[model samples]
Target: MIFDYLIYVFLGIGLFFNVLAGVGLLRFPDVYTRLHAGTKCTTFGSIFLIGSVILIGLKLWWEKDTNGSVLALHSALALVAILLTNPVGAHAIARAAHRSGVKPVRAIADHLAESPPLQTGEKTDKKQQPQEEGGK
Candidate 1:
């Protein structure tokens, strides 16, 4: 009885965070915030979702179901993958966006603004801008 209730609680919490992630993606003002919300919320949500699954598998295994071991193992592996990949992927996306000159909407403080630019082979001519696509 208590175990089942624990699963239900985990399910509810997971669902809430996942829904919040979707809302954040749709409603956030800028790329950084959107990515932050999506990655963080989903990671947290997935932890609980998979945790409940693992609990279910353990419950079944306790009842002598062989498949429960497989289920539990797979869920644990997936949870590990999600934990490892989500943040790294989000960071890559944000870094690419920043490098491509995507500025935050109405940002007050930019920490990256002070960081030294990446070193390229050719010197960056600050005074010279890239030619416009339709330049005569």
Candidate 2:
């Protein structure tokens, strides 16, 4: 009975975070903020949801059920995958978005632009180039 209640609580928390992520994605003004909300919220939500499954699996395994062991193992593996991939994927997307010229809203300082690494054959916009003293 207690285990069931715990499972319900975990599920509820997970659902709440997931819903919050959706809301953030929809309500945020810029891509960076949206990505922040979406990625962090979803990752946190998935943790709770998967945790509930792990608990269920443990309970079953304690009862000497083989399926319970399998379920627990698989759930753990899934959690690991999510933990490893979510932030990295979000980072990649954010970097790509920045590289493609999407600027954050109301940003005061752009660190990436200030110290960009050298890349051979990179084209600079005409406006970025220095004009000759005599207007060559």
Candidate 3:
């Protein structure tokens, strides 16, 4: 049936993107780049894969199957969950990595360094200032 062919095509496309994500994870030089590739590719692949499931569910439901309705609903919920969480999780991971002192390759300016979070006023010695006007 045409629907079956459609499912196969979706699955194939999903598989391709998923594989690309894996390759990107391995090939990218830095954490941010890897996170970008991994998150975007996996999210896109999951959309197609879940879409195929939804289509199958709809087909079955059209044939008056109760289980198909459940499958479709659950697949839709899962897709929503993936859409919401994937990017957020990736962003959290990248932020954590940066905070932990991992610098991006060839990055010139770190904006986070310019504006720090509000701090309670506590006097601390400025370490980076020159101790003497000339070399002691």
Off by over 4 Å in 1: 108-111, 117-136
Poorly placed runs, candidate 2 (over 4 Å):
114-121, 125-136
Query: Where does candidate 1 have its weakest 10-residue lDDT segment?
Result: 114-123
TM agreement with the true structure for every prediction: 0.83, 0.83, 0.80
Q: What C-alpha RMSD separates each model from the true structure?
A: 7.3, 7.9, 9.1
Clashes per model (N, Cα, C within 3 A): 0, 0, 0
TM-score of 1: 0.83
Model 3's number of clashes is 0
lDDT of 2: 0.88
Candidate 1, 12-65: lDDT as tens digits:
999999999999999999999999889999999999999999999999999999
Scored by Cα lDDT, where does model 3 land? Answer: 0.87
Q: Pick the lDDT winner.
A: 2
Model 3 steric clash pairs: none
Candidate 2 matches the true fold with a TM-score of 0.83
Candidate 1: clashing pairs of residues:
none
